[model samples]
Target chain A: MPSETPAAYDPSAYPPFAVTVDLVVLTIRAGALRVLLVRRATEPFAGRLALPGGFVQIDEDLLPAARRELAEETGVRLGRAHLEQLGTYGHPDRDPRMRVVSVAYLALVPDLAQPVAGTDAAEADLVPVAAVEPLDRLAFDHGRILADGLERARAKLTYTTLATTFCPPEFTVTELRAVYEAVWGTTVDPRNFHRKVLASDGFVEPTGETTTRGGGRPAQLHRQGSAEQLHPPLTR
Target chain B: MPSETPAAYDPSAYPPFAVTVDLVVLTIRAGALRVLLVRRATEPFAGRLALPGGFVQIDEDLLPAARRELAEETGVRLGRAHLEQLGTYGHPDRDPRMRVVSVAYLALVPDLAQPVAGTDAAEADLVPVAAVEPLDRLAFDHGRILADGLERARAKLTYTTLATTFCPPEFTVTELRAVYEAVWGTTVDPRNFHRKVLASDGFVEPTGETTTRGGGRPAQLHRQGSAEQLHPPLTR
Candidate 1:
């Protein structure tokens, strides 16, 4: 309830603004990167698709609110997924009804089943990034939020072991490389990619198991290593 | 104003929370990296050194609010400084009075004159990072914000040309190295540092000027170049 003015500095002088949390939930599905979007059921872009989000509860922390909203909207528990603060959007005119500030969260979850519409959403679905041209058309500056989240995810793959977050517990090197390819939207040289990934110590560790799912030569499986960062980042 | 509960979905049902912006202003001064902090004059950790900051205006954007608070508290203009959204803090109990969420900003400015305490502050001064051992002692989660900002500044220097933000418009390689040393708190090999910085394309460009301020050897002046990212980042 802190006032906007500094001279008087009253805690309750300024009108309160609604604070909300938005989740940009992303996953790699069918060899493409997709994001979860919900259809707004109310006015103020009523029919437009928007990111899954809601107001933060008065008793909750920022991350907890984000987790609660994500779960309520998509029925996805954030157990092992990677979630981080993206940014806050507080343009006075962003929300039509009144002043509302939204703290966005970027979540990278392993491939999951399709999402279902929750309480506040009319519909929910996973939309491929390539299908959504001119992302600015989404509800209430959400296009900008989505773009920022995607950029953060793509950039994080270069230096962090976040790419592993998109894979199963034990995954082949090809599977890990596919994550980079899908997120970056480009083909990578398999040989060079393998060499570079392996050269970066603690990026991935062998599980001593091989996958012959395609009836070809068995590919060794690996799991995420302890190191969080790539010493020499795999630049795009 | 969005409601806190999804079941009712009333925009006006929930009370509004106060939103503020806190700034972590950093600069390289006197061969050390220091942050600008203000001693509070009001209750709730009064007399404790906290980052200079204030409430966001109803009509202003987040960045503008940060700039205004920073200038008012420290008498430093953000005209040439590098500013970016750091993160948002929204623990319901962060403020004892009410629910307050703070959007934090990180700013890197060139060395400047000493600061004068402005409104809402009893004292304003630049304290070296080494001096603030347990940064968490600052007023109301500011210490954690400062730690996060410092880690971000260090990590950014590895992959971005952000080191230039700490230097003046025209500076020598030695002066640039000093920035790295001060922020990272480690001495870098001059020869290797020079070679690496120069090899990184568009990192810095020669200004065809020389300065012998220290009276050792004339050092050529350089300016920040167009590239924003450093490929094969210089790791610690």
Candidate 2:
């Protein structure tokens, strides 16, 4: 504890730390929640699967840095993805090469084509959330990060209109309910869910279109409305 | 970007960053929500009000760093303060001296004795939230950080039992409603609020005691329950 005086201050005397951004890009495909992961090709955790990320550039903003790491490691563009800051991790020993503090981001995106491993990763692929554990383990505390991201997604889906991010621009009520079922790993009553969703004003608006993609009859398509937060959250 | 191989890797090549922790310690005092602030004793923003904070030590964890800075700058020992990480702010030019990434924390504490400025601050005091802006402003990006913390507190109050943190161990249902009023800066209907709180199970439980400190009939005391997230949130 030294006195706070300019004459005695030395900014360069502080310890140096490296900052990086890790992304937990999630999407639902075939009624399953999946996360985009990469096989690391570097030393500390060589050839092990991890959430795609890298060292942030000096002049880059935190959000852009996360998107850059996502694109560079997986070669998948982040177009129309719902990206947000999840949290930051600084366990001191989380990275072995040096003291690295990583800012983690959560992204909800529509299912796209399979990712190609970019220069940063040995291989890249979308792994099902349920199939990830008790089988192939992730590297460098990634399992914990992925868990947090999933919880955030599940919790936000209950109170916000973010579930539409997992669907296409136009989606049926059944398709949107499947997002909640996939993320929460539970089945929701179709009649009850449809009534609640239609009751929540500013949550969804009809597109004046019909889609018979899934069977039975042509269901009306809807899109996310202008509400940022739901008043009476849809309780599961 | 180079090949991801140990032989060609240089961890030292990454840009260096100095990490710090800034806290938004809030409390309800005199029917108003107040924040703990310090007058910087050093250059950059000397003699101006800023949230109490400091650089993180080389071996300290982020939460401990936040607690240490609170004690060091405002002489506030954070006993029983509800503390949590709010977010991380890292604009490239936020700190004129260097690139400093600050992890902001939110702490909801019961009102305590007047603060004595510690070694890091020239002066310290609790300022009303409504009185902060359009008058003396905070240093750096602290204004934005304060707004984020305030929003978090207001939002969490609607869905969580954290509003009790602003009160003593034993409190009447009426006193609890005052906490919501002070933080949200609005009037809450007393009868409706009491009915809602009592209806929400695991939100509050009767203490089998009564208090008559507010010049009314003996009011039954209640304490927070075991629930983390409310099912049917007590909406305002």
Candidate 3:
């Protein structure tokens, strides 16, 4: 408090901190909510399961950091994915060694035509959300990050048009409905959901095509709509 | 890189870092969305304007850090306020000297009754969101944090019942509508907003009394209802 003036604040007074970005990349592979996780090749928790992450570099914002980390770890381009800033993880003890603050993001990628793992990563796998048994045991506070990401994704579906992020470029209404059911962990009335979708004009438009991939029925195909936000949002 | 197995990452390998929290405390004052900001009383940016904030302690969660900073600088108890994590700011050079990761939060105070200045704050004042000319040049990257907080508040009002957080525990319908108008920076159709509120169900409930303060038509008194989430949320 020696200097009462703000201009005199010495930049050297505080210690430098290292910042990193972590991602809980989510996708639906084979009708299940799956999270993309990586095995750490380095300690303190080396060999344990964790999310794909890296130290955020200079010359970029937090959003780009998340994108960079995701791409580096998974070799997947997040351009078409629904990316958002989840929150920050900054418990002094969250990192045992240095004061490393991590900015976490929730990303939704539709089915990938192919997924390649990072070079330094020991192992990378898509684990089902329901299969994260004893959810409390994830390494390095990642369990908490996963839970928060799931809740944010669920809540976003209620008011935003983010459910489509989990679908293919062209998908059937049935496929869209499945996305909601999987994320919410509850079954919604198909009829009601269909009616609601149609009522919300401009939310989706028919592509004059059909999909025969699912086998049972030839469902009409539709691409993503232009609605940035849902008016009178579809509530859970 | 020497060992066949990855080396045990030592906490001591990296330099120690500083952690801090910045708060965007908002309320509706004088029919405008107002934010609480403080003029820096100490260096880095003494006499210059900045958001109310401080360094984080050795043991504290990101949110608790934000809340503690709020109370210390603004003398406001965050226990009763609507507080939620906004996001984190952690650019490598966000702090000129070292790496300082700042966790930012958006808090809504129903009523900002009295503010006492302490800590590194010069004078805590509620500045109109539209009148932040002097605050445009904030300490560090806080100008960006404030802008992001305002945008979130505006968007949140559209889908959630968070606008009520800018009002007192008990308020009238007109007052509630005013909250929306102020935050969105646009006037809403009173009749439409009122009908929408009633139809939403559980947003507000009658207190069986009328406000005796207003000179015009006496307004019905109401209190916050039990609606946890707004389905088919009110949009701009």
**Among all candidates shown, the one with the greatest DockQ:** 2
Q: Give the per-residue lDDT digits (tens) of candidate 3, residues B1-236.
A: 10123556564444355667788889878898888877765656667667777676556677787777777766666645788888877676777655667788898887677654556527778888888865458888888999999888877777677777777877888899999888877888988888887777778888888986757878888877677475465855
- Which numbered prediction scores highest in lDDT against the true structure? 1
Q: Rank the candidates by TM-score, best first.
A: 1, 2, 3
lDDT tens digits, residue span A1-236, model 2: 12243674455677778888888889998889999877776667777778877777788888888887766755556656788999888877777777778889998888876545666536778889888864336777788889999888888888898888888878999999999899888999999999988888878899999989989999999987777575566656
lDDT (C-alpha) at residue A210 in model 3: 91
Across residues B38-85, which tens digit of lDDT does each residue of candidate 1 receive? 777676777787887777777777888888877776667665688899
Query: Which residue runs does candidate 2 get wrong by more than 4 Å?
Result: A1-5, A8-11, A75-79, A134-137, B1-5, B8-11, B74-79, B205-207
Q: How high is the DockQ of candidate 3? A: 0.35
Chain A TM-score, each candidate? 0.90, 0.90, 0.90
Q: Tens digit of lDDT per residue, candidate 2, span B157-210?
A: 887888888877778888899999888778989999999888887877899998
TM-score-wise, the better of 2 and 3 is 2
| Residue pairs of candidate 2 with colliding backbone atoms | none
- How high is the lDDT of residue B232 in model 3? 60
Candidate 3 chain B least-lDDT 10 residues: B1-10
TM-score of chain B of 1: 0.91
Interface RMSD of 1: 3.8
Scored against the true structure, residue B84 in model 3 reaches a CA lDDT of: 87
